[model samples]
Structure formats: structure tokens, C-alpha cells
Target chain A: MPRSVRVRLFATARLAVGRAVLPWPVPEHGLRARELVAALEQAYPRLAPTLRGSRFLRNDRYLRDLDETLRPGDEFAVHPPYGGG
Target chain B: MAVRLTRRPLTLAEAERRLRARPGGAVVVFAGRVRRDRRRGSSVVALEYEVDRVPALARLRALERAARRRFGASELVLWHRLGRVRVGEVAVVVGATCPHRVEAFDAARYLIDELKTTVPIWKEERGRPVRRPPRRRARPGVRSAGSGRAP
Candidate 1:
């Protein structure tokens, strides 16, 4: 069974993804950062296009690559470029 | 002293009174209001501003630190509105108090300026006159017009 993780969305991310929080089922080995992105893209079709070239943050730190394993209880957020001045 | 984020309209008197109670010699405040125009060339019948509280609060806290360090203010209060805001509604208010006028004024200005570029917010124009996002190549850099959502 895949580890279940909580995905939290905020601001533009919430608007695009259409929810404030989501439960993600990851593989037993755990989902890597990149794999999470692909899963998110699959889950939210409307957000998939926007996710292209967007950035990801695990907790507060920015994730540059997907090799990091997803931890249970971990909160992930997808951040679009901040457009505010 | 207090950093507040709400969708309801802000009260200038409340902000001023709170700052004055802190024994500061000077208090400076900046309020951003919704206007009649939007980036997409929309007539801006109305606006809805949206904010993600988790990251938004984090960013605000960082700004408070920066304001205190750069302007030497005694206290700072930053309040922002998130949700649909009608035209002419108050969207944000940042108040800074200090022992001198210089620190008060500088801190207030710096806080607003930095927030415009740093915060993660979104704005959606509604009703009429749809406006398009500005071309990235446009000169004179446009500030991100925040979402119309109110808290």
C-alpha cells in the first residue's frame, strides 16, 4: 500500500487545484518529488497545464529536484510564480 | 505590534489608535485600495483577492523583521485583506510606529513596496471589461494586481 500524504494548497495554488487539501496515495517505496508532481498533474487536470514549469515546496523549503522521498504526514504545496508586486 | 490578515474592510482608526497606544512619537500608515482598472484592460467592475494564509503569514513575518531592521521602527502592524473587494475598498494596511517621523515614514513605505513584490496573492477582475495579463516584456514593470477575494 502507498503511504498517504496530505497536500495543502494555498492562494493561487488552491485556486488552480480546486481544493484546500488533498490526500495523496503514494507507492510503498514513497513518492519522490518529481513523481509527486506527475501524480498531481494526473489528479488535477485543470492545474496540470499551469504546473508545467512551476515550482514545488515541501514544507517551507523549495524542492529543486524530485529525488526526495515523500514522508508520511508531510505537507506539500505547489507554488505558482508570485505575481504580486 | 500586530499582524492581521482579514477579508473584511479595514478600519483606519483602529490601526492608528493601536499604534498610538504604544508610546511612539510617530506613526505612519499605508493603505492599498481597489481601483477601477485591472491589468487585463478590464473596466474592473469589481475585484476578488485571494491569499494562502500559511505562506502569506510567513512572508508577512519576514517583512516585519525587515521593516524593523531597515527603518528602526519601534513597532509595526501589517494587515491585509483577502477576498472579493469592491471598487474603492481597502485591500491592505501597514502601520509603523517609531520615536521619530523619519523611521515611521520610511518603514511604512518600505513595507508596502516590498510586499507588492514579495507576497503570494492573486486577483481576479469581475463583471465587465475583461483584462488580459500584461506582456512580460512590457516596460515600466507592472505590479501584481491582487485577487478580488475578501476575507
Candidate 2:
């Protein structure tokens, strides 16, 4: 059986924290970071507006698209524009 | 006091004190301040700074580590102040302690230069561009991501 992937969010992404862990179902071979975001938005309609305006990161680096396949133990995040001081 | 970010006021003396060590031979300090330009009045208005802390800290730690490895410096300090700062107030301060003048000076300059292009901090011009679409402010130690450097 394929192991379930763990996703972590920070800053703006943490808004979907109604539950500590969401049982994210992944594709048989796993999905990319962007696809995970799409699935997350579908599951949590309340976060739709924020989902449109956010950028996603797999690990600490920014991901260019949603189709990048997720690897086991890969961490994901959604970030909002933070003003730089 | 040292190697930290603060939302309150920045004190130069405190920064120097933090960087100065008993056995270190030299201490270097660099303070970035607000200056009046033609766009503003004779007196400068307040300067506001915003930062994305997560990425900012990541880059800061990277830069500091690089400096330490390349220079073999004894110690280093970084302080950044946010919110309404008046003219001549310190925005960012960097201090390095080393055994000689050359390493201290070189590391300090490198840190400041990298900061301007990389650290993900933005500035507001205050008077102009207020009504325009919210633009991303320029940050130290950062480039547009295709420059091929670590910004």
C-alpha cells in the first residue's frame, strides 16, 4: 500500500487548521505540489479566495506549478505576500 | 540585542556593544538610514519597512554562514527595524568582529551589498506611488530570480 503523504503549511496556509492533520488522498504514484493545492481548495471551499492568491512551496523552495509530483515526506506550504521590511 | 530583528527602535550603541568582544581585535559597524530625496520635502518623512520573516531569516542565516566560512570571523550581528522610522534613523545595522581590519571591513561590505538585493525586505517611498497598485518594494540581497546569483 502507498503511504499517505504528510503536508505542512505555515503563515497564511495555516488558516486551514480546523484539524491538525487532514487525510490527504494522493494519486497512486503521488501528485505534485500544485495538484495538492487544487485538491485542498476543493476539499475546503472556505479557503477559495485565499487559495487563488497564494504561492506554494515544496520544501523551502517555491514550486513553479501544481503538476509537480509529490514525494513521500515532502512538505508543502502556501504563502501570502508579506511586506519586506 | 544581536543577530535579531526588532519592530521597535534600533540603537547603534547597543549594536556596537553586542558586537564588541573582549578578545576581538576589530569591530565593524554599518548602519542604513533614511535620507531625503527630491520626491520628499526638505525634511524626510517616515520610512516604513516590511519583511517576509521566514525567507528573510533563511537567507540571513545563509549569508551569515557564508561570511563566517569565507572570512573566519569571530562574531557577527544583524539588526533590522520595522515600521515608521524618521529621517536619519537606522533601518538596518550589521556588525562583525574579526582579528584584523581587512576581514571585518570586507565582510561588512559584502553583507550589506547582499542584503540590499536578497533579504526580502521592501520599502515605501512614502509620498509618491501611494495611489498606484501596491508594488513590491525593493529588498536587499535579492534579484528578480534570473540573475544567476544567490539573491
Candidate 3:
């Protein structure tokens, strides 16, 4: 109910974070994608490596770069390098 | 469908049927199957595949478009299976129909390679522990020849 970002993790990212989704609290004004990533890395050191190789998505849309801002209630997804055949 | 991600089995017949949608002189179909491999002394029995549905489907559609634009593919089928897939079972199939063989082959190859790196899908291996031979028991008679205490 409170202002928070729903962070989705998959594959190695999910393994590291031990969850498929995390409710990350953020400022009402929104947070820079870069800063949010930094905070996630700081919070879950094990997920740092995966974060470095992952692509970010906000509301199911790919983020061109980390410069994009993520607002409250947004769904942020972390996609690791794909291994599908 | 030109692009799809489903749990159902992928077959060449299905791919061929899809490729029949439009007329083309040449067709190329590629199927990838799970392999029975030993990992860390365990025999892999199956693979559990997972996918981020929306993104994965989006990428597949993008690949389909690229194939059509680059290779002039008249028909295409890109299908991948999710959930448990046993060794030797088809896991994915990508095919293309072009005016000639060269383009068909090239397009099929591109579709598969790009799908591997672009699609949001991953597979986890499931293995069965290796069985070890039973230890032989020594014969219980005659004080055991060479029992070191006092020969």
C-alpha cells in the first residue's frame, strides 16, 4: 500500500537475492535507476555480481540505461544474461 | 504462430506446417534437444526451464521481424518449451522459409543464436546421483589369513 517499487529478479539474480520479487521502498518523487541499483547492491552483496550483468526494466519495459528514474509502485525487473537455446 | 513460448513439445512437423503458410522455395528448420550429461558425478536426467514470459515473447517477435526483413523469410516458426524437458527431447525449434536455401539457412541460424542471447529464458539441470559399486565383504573363516595381530 505504501509507496514502494516492486523489484523482480530472475535466474541468477533470483538465486542470489533468494526471492523472485522484492518490495523496495523509494522516495515519492522517485529514485534514479542508478541509485536504486546501488542501494540494492549494498543491501544484497550476493546480488551485486548478477546486477552487473543484468538489464533493468520498469513496468515491463526495458530501461535504455540506468539514467532512467524508477517511481513508487513501479515494477522493476532484473534480467540476467539469457541462456535459452 | 510465428513466435511462441509454450510448455508443449516442439516438433519438426509443427514447424513444417507453419512454414507452409507462405510459399517459399527453400526451408530450413533447426531443433535443439536436451542432452544426457554428467555433471559433478551426477547424471543429468532433465532440464527445468524458466522464462520471463512478456520479455521473452517480445524478443522472439523481434527476431521474427528481423528474419523477415533481412532474409526475406516468407514464413517462420520460433517455438521453445518451458518446464521439465527430458534428455533427448526437443527443447526448441526455429525455422525459416526463404526464396533460396542460403537465406533460409542464414535466417534460421540467426533466429536461434539471437534467441539464445536475447530471450529471457534459463534452464536448470536436474540430475540423479551416481550409483557406486558395493564393497566386497571378506570371507569369515579361519581367523582371516594375514590378520596382522600375531602371524
**Which candidate leads in TM-score?**
3
Candidate number of the best DockQ: 3
Indicate the TM-score of model 3: 0.89
Question: For model 2, what is the alpha-carbon lDDT of residue A71?
Answer: 74
TM-score of chain B, candidates 1 onward in order: 0.77, 0.77, 0.86
lDDT of 3 at B41: 86
TM-score of each: 0.73, 0.58, 0.89
lDDT of 2 by residue, A4-74 (tens): 56665433445555542454667667777767777788877866676787766666666787778877666
Candidate 2: regions farther than 4 A off: A1-60, A63-85, B40-44, B128-151
Runs in model 1 deviating more than 4 A are: A10-21, A41-49, A52-55, A60-66, A83-85, B38-41, B129-151
Error of 2 at B119 (Å): 1.2
Each candidate structure's count of clashing pairs: 25, 23, 0
Candidates, ranked, lDDT? 3, 1, 2
Write model 2 residue lDDT over B55-81, tens digit each, in one string: 678878888898888877778877787
Q: Which scores higher on DockQ, 1 or 3?
A: 3
Candidate 3: residue B108 lDDT (0-100): 92
